[model samples]
Target chain A: MARNPIRDEIAIVGLGSTGFYRDSGGRSAKALACDASIRAIRDAGFEPGDIDGIVGAAEPGGPNPNEMSAALGLPQVTHFSSPMPVAVFALVDAMNAIFSGSCSTVLLYFAYTRLPWNSRSAAEDPFRRHHTLGVMPAPESVNAAAAYAAWASRYIHEYDARREDFGRVALNARAGAARNPLAVMKTPLSMEGYLQARMIREPLCLLDMDIPVDGADAFVLTRTECAREKTRNPVVVHAATTGLVGTNDEDQLPSLRRHGQHVVVESLRAKSDLWLEDMDIFFPYDGFSIITLGWIENFGWCPPGGAGRFLEEHWDPEAGCVMIDGRIPLNPHGGSLSEGATRGSGHIREAVMQLRGDAGERQVAGARNALIGCGGFFFNSQGAILRRL
Target chain B: MSEDVDDAALIERFPYVRIDHDSKHFYRGWLDERLLFNRCDACERFHHPPKPVCPSCWCASLTPTEVSGRGVIHLAMFLHQGPPAPGVDYAMAAHPVVAVELEEQEGLRFTSTVIGCPREAIRIGLPVELGWVERFGAPFPVFRPVEGS
Candidate 1:
């Protein structure tokens, strides 16, 4: 195993969210980002002057690191960067900056907004229309989002997986959302409702994909030494990693059994002193239900093509969600499906809350460890283990 | 052979595609109704969606080689709603898109919509041969069910 000196070295001291929404009610993405960042700083028991580093995910319409720092009136910032989204990239960047002493305190932020391509109302709005796809793409390509559906077809054919398997993932997310006031789609969903959902991309329907919304999540990170000195028991990053394989092309991906998710699982396992048996909560990304299944199987929660059956066996009908072996709850925060796509920021935020015992009604009793499998299977796959000490 | 086509004319031909220097040859092949993939001369392996160097051996000696455009469908999806494209009517029918695992090389695949076949027949493992259709007055590569397969 490669050395992981940084394991449990950094702690997330503060967390803030603008509470996801379908529309920001006229608030721009920059405005949402500033709102969340300010709250995060305050939650950390620090003022804007305490923040010396800024790392912002380069979300489509989100603000930059400097913009967030400036908007929040941070006095000075020694390190600032705009990493590509899905949360952990910025997390890793912030952690490295803190460890390397580029900055003592870092405010990592992510903001999302409904853009013209994804939302019709956003398209009609004059401000959002400027965010254009400079070059139109023919429908023949399976490059990005379309690849999930294309591969979901393969996943079904190869494993004889039914629509119900994907449905369960949606059902679980919806159930969690009902308890999560921050979520947008709180209406309880049944298996029948999911099966009959509108088929935007066949084999994967509207419920299979993440709901786009305007919101923001931000966090304050500092050295573990500082965190322990400030708080009685602060949650820390036990291990964090982003992974990719050589065959990253959506269509060219060798098969479901292998991809970035597998790499992430392997890397996290190597770095982490904690394992699934020690995990108190699980946050598998539900950007696409198929992606969640990929994490389930790739993380060795079950064998290949076994997530569908495993989820059924471990399903907590009372909770209306998957409670693994009647203990661990998957994505207690409603997740991207119902919680509005924070591009894994929602997952990270929820993990932080659960570890800090601040998850309100969704909190697991005495939660201590959180295993988050973030991003999709191809290029963006990431995983993290957060622990409270 | 395609050097005569200026960049402006090339972009005009494929207005929807963002063609850079590396992929110009591949898209240029589409204008001639020929599909091309970058084949590394050293290892003779094929890669798609065009990369500058061969992933296998890191050799920049690449050729935009044309294959038989014959393959089996490895991944398939239908779009009930999607981006606007010519000759596609999502309201009337679900448009099909497929990624075919080309026989020339393992895992070397090209993605396109299948035509001249019932939607039911468009599925994984379906044998297909490359075909062409016009989109915005330019050749668009497509797939069709291979005869007797």
Candidate 2:
């Protein structure tokens, strides 16, 4: 809480992303990153040379900051890094660079191709490998689904939550995506369909998982004053923080197993002036339905293990929940479940769009503030509070 | 499912032990038909999946202690499908993966499969007992429903 100087000091002035798809075979991850960067810079009313800093969300085999800078033909990039795989970590880095007077404008982006099922990238997860006791990991352990399934199963046990409860989260995501043109899964997801879907892991149906789509999303962050000059709707960074507290050192897994939202959000709440009620939209990272549930509890939106009842009573797949629309919308951009997994950028961009009033069909009316949650599966937690200025 | 190669190849690809400095003793416990966890000599806290240093007290001194291997299923999932990967072809339809909170420790849990019971019968909080199964020529820890409990 000491010296919270970065609050409202930085703003997102521009945003751009490649069209989401199941498999964008023609483009490499670098190409997607470059394209998104170019469009985002242009959207911010600047060219490649105008960007003095760059931060990239870590992607497997994706372009680093230097590669992206070279590809974008940027004349100078004083601050450049792509060290972390977590998306929110990268965004926070960009905000820090601007806050520290290290750079004026920062380009932040994440890009990746949906590797083929037979591809090695599927087993490239460092967490699974590390947790596997240095032995060959079970195929289930190799995929993120296993980790989520572990969490979901634990959630179900502790809360007596049902698959139907988690199903609602997926149902709402698909419903939101049906309205989003950039979303990959457009078809309606019903409870019946969700229940009938093939189980990827016990407690986790295929619908409960995210589609690894090939795409890239970019955002332009600058000083609040400069952002206002660049664009009429500059989304102010209300609060941003990242840390590994209560997470394992080796695997970076949450120390509490199925809990991390409190650790991340509590730190964020300490730094921000807003409460759960002040936000217009909630994009608690939907890497898993149970994760979103954790965020719901950890943020005091509902009590711990009460997310099922809260969601069942609050969320409606048809008209969109009054909780999401009237009170606060959750993942209004269809989230990672339906929206292609642009890491957390898709969530961040959707929050950005909602705050800017540019979210055509999914816009939260008179939106002012948005809360974005990132990184729980990796045990690390990152959060951001954005407000429309 | 076994067409690609043999059981050995499949098990090697999806190993149960990484055989690190901290975990070698833990896997050795499996070979001895015992479920072992790292017990911090300083704080007396139990660490699952074997860590070199105690997570609670940050003490490097630890010992692998055997447990009764009786646990309650903290959570359970049935993997009926899998991702498309050459190494992942070993997943059988309707495989039950359970996170069992060992009775020895309050929150100590590990990812293991539940066998000897119908996959549908596996539920969270179900009492389970560790049962060793030969996987890749080594004793791999698996769980089964503890009857009458």
lDDT of 1 at A5: 93
Model 2 ranges with Cα > 4 A deviation: A1-3, A118-136, A139-144, A231-233, A243-258, A316-327, B1-17, B83-93
State the lDDT of candidate 1 residue by residue for A221-288, as single tens digits: 99999998898798999999999999898989988988999999999999988899999999999999
Fnat scores for every prediction: 0.94, 0.54
Best prediction by lDDT: 1
In angstroms and one decimal each, the interface RMSD of every candidate reads 0.7, 4.6
Give the number of the best model, judged by TM-score.
Answer: 1
TM-score of predicted structure 1, chain A: 0.99
Residue A303 of model 1, lDDT score: 94
- List the lowest-lDDT window of 10 residues for candidate 1 chain A: A64-73
Enumerate residue pairs that collide in model 1. Answer: none
